[model samples]
Target: MSAKTIVVGNFKGGVGKTKVAVMASWELAHEMNKKVLLIDMDPQANATTLIARSAGITEIESSIFESFENSDLSKSVLNVKENLDLIPAAVSFKNLPKFLYGKFSDDIDQVSYLKTLLEPLKKNYDYIFIDVPPTISDYSDNAMMAADYVLIILQAQELSLEGAETYISYLQFMIDEYNAYIQVAGVLPVLLRPGGRVDHATVERAKELFGEDNVFENYIKHLERLKAWDITGITYKDHHDNRAHQIFIEVVQEMLDKIEHFEGGEVNGE
Candidate 1:
C-alpha cells in the first residue's frame, strides 16, 4: 500500500479542526488496522494530550519545534500509543518565526526540513495526519507541501466559511507557486447545532463553493460522542453506542475513497 498524509487545518480557530484530526488519526490507527503518525503542529497540543491520555502515557510537551533548531529526532518524537506515534508541541514553538527564518541561516530549506526528516519513516506508517494551527506559518506550509493531500475542516458558520476561504486561497497559491504536485484532500463539514437554522443552508453553500467532488459525503452532525469518548478513555469507533461509531466509520471510508480517486487518476492518466 502507498503512504498518505492528510493535513487538518483552517485559518480560523475554534471549529473542531483538532478534534477531527485526532478522531481521524485514531480511527485509522485503531479501527482500520493502519499504522498512523499523528503530528501535533498546533502549539496547544490538544491532539497530543488526548491520545497520550487515552494510552495512559504522559502528556507531551516537547515537539517538532525543537526539530527546527535541533538535529536529534528522538527528542522531538514520542510513541504515544500502540500503532501510533506523535511529534508533540512546545510553548517555545510560538516564538519560532525568527528562529526559523533568521537564525537558521545558510543552507537549510526549513520549509522542507520536516519532509526530509520524515522520508526514512514513511515506510513505517500507512497514514500521517498533521494537525495545524489557525495561523499561517512555515510549519503549516511545510506540512501541507509535504502532504499527498490536504483536508480542511469547516463548521457551518459565517466565520468558519471566512477561514476556509482564506485557507483554500492560500493553498491554491502554494500549489501554483511551489507545490504543483499537491492535491486537496477534501473539505469536511462539521455542522454546528446540526439542525439549527441556516446550518443546512450553510452546508449547501459549502458544497456549491468547494465543488461537489471536494466535499465529504458524510457531514458530521453536532454530537456528544466526541466529548464522551474523550473523557471516558475510549475511541469513537469503540464506543458501545454504535450509531455514532458508524457515522465516523463512514467518514473514514469516504476519505479513503477520495484519496483513492486521486491515486487512480495518477496511475491512469497523470
Candidate 2:
C-alpha cells in the first residue's frame, strides 16, 4: 500500500493542531508499529520541536522547503526513532513564500509542487503526516494539495468551531480551483470540557455543521500533562498519565479506521 498522507490543519491558531499532529503520529508509530513520516510544514515548527525534543535533537540541519527548491527530499529527512521519521522546519522557512512566487507563474501548478516532491517517496512509509500553519498560505496550500486526507483540529469553543468551518471551506476551494484530490478524514474536537454547557453546545453545533459521522466520536479532554509538554518538552509517555495517553490511543485508532475505510473503499471502487 502507498503512504497515506494526512495534513493536520486549521485556519485559526492555538486550537491544538500541532498537539494532535504530534501525538497522533507518535501513537501510530510507537503503539501501532507503523512507519510514519511527519513533515513540519509550519514555519513555527512546534511539531518539529516536540518530536525533536523527545528524540534529544537540538538542531535541525535542513528544512522541508529545501525539497521544494532543490528537488532533494532526503536532505530534510531525519530518523527520529524506530518507526518515526521527520522532515523538520526552520525559521528560514518563513521566506519560502517569496521563493515560491518566483518559481511559479500564473499558469503553473504552484499548489502541486509539494505533491510532486513527495510522490517519489509515496511507498516508503505507511503514513505521512504534515503539520500546517493556521492560515491559508503558499505553504499550507502545498500541504493541502499534497495530502490524501485533511484532519482538521477544533477546540470545544465557539470560535474554534467557526474556524473548523472556515478550513472546510478552504478545502473545497482547493478542490474546485486546483483539482486537488483530497477529502476530509474528520474534524477532531480537542480541549473537551465534558460538563460545561458551552462545550455541550459546541459539540452539538459541530455535529450539526459537519454531520455526526464527519466529527470524531472520541474527543481529547484538556489535561495538565498536555499543557506541560509545551514548556518542558516532555512526551505523553514521560508523564505516565493514563488519561491523556488513552485519549491519544483512541484518536489513533479512530484515525486508522477512517484511513483504512477510506482507502479500501477507493480500491474497491465504492
Q: Write the per-residue lDDT of candidate 2 for residues 72-129, one digit (tens) a residue.
A: 7777899999889998988888988787778888623677778888888877888899
| Tens-digit per-residue lDDT, 1-270, candidate 1 | 446878887888777787788878777777787888888877777777777777787655567778767755556777866777888776777766666677556323656666767776677778888888888887687777778778877676443378888888988877876753567778887765645334666667777888879878686666766666667654535445466666677788888888878777442111
In order, the Cα lDDT scores of the candidates are 0.73, 0.81
Candidate 1 local lDDT, residue 23? 77
> Model 1: how far is 236 from its true place, Å?
7.0
Residue 182's lDDT in candidate 1: 65
Instruction: Estimate candidate 1's alpha-carbon lDDT, on a 0 to 1 scale.
Output: 0.73
Clashing pairs in 1: none
Pick the TM-score winner. Answer: 2
| Clashes within 3 Å, all models in order | 0, 0
Q: Once superposed on the true structure, which residue ranges of model 2 sit more than 4 Å away at CA?
A: 192-198, 236-240, 265-270
- Stretches of candidate 1 exceeding 4 Å from the true structure: 59-62, 72-75, 103-108, 157-160, 194-198, 229-232, 235-242, 265-270
Candidate 2 minimal-lDDT segment of 10 residues:
261-270
What TM-score does structure 2 among the candidates reach?
0.91
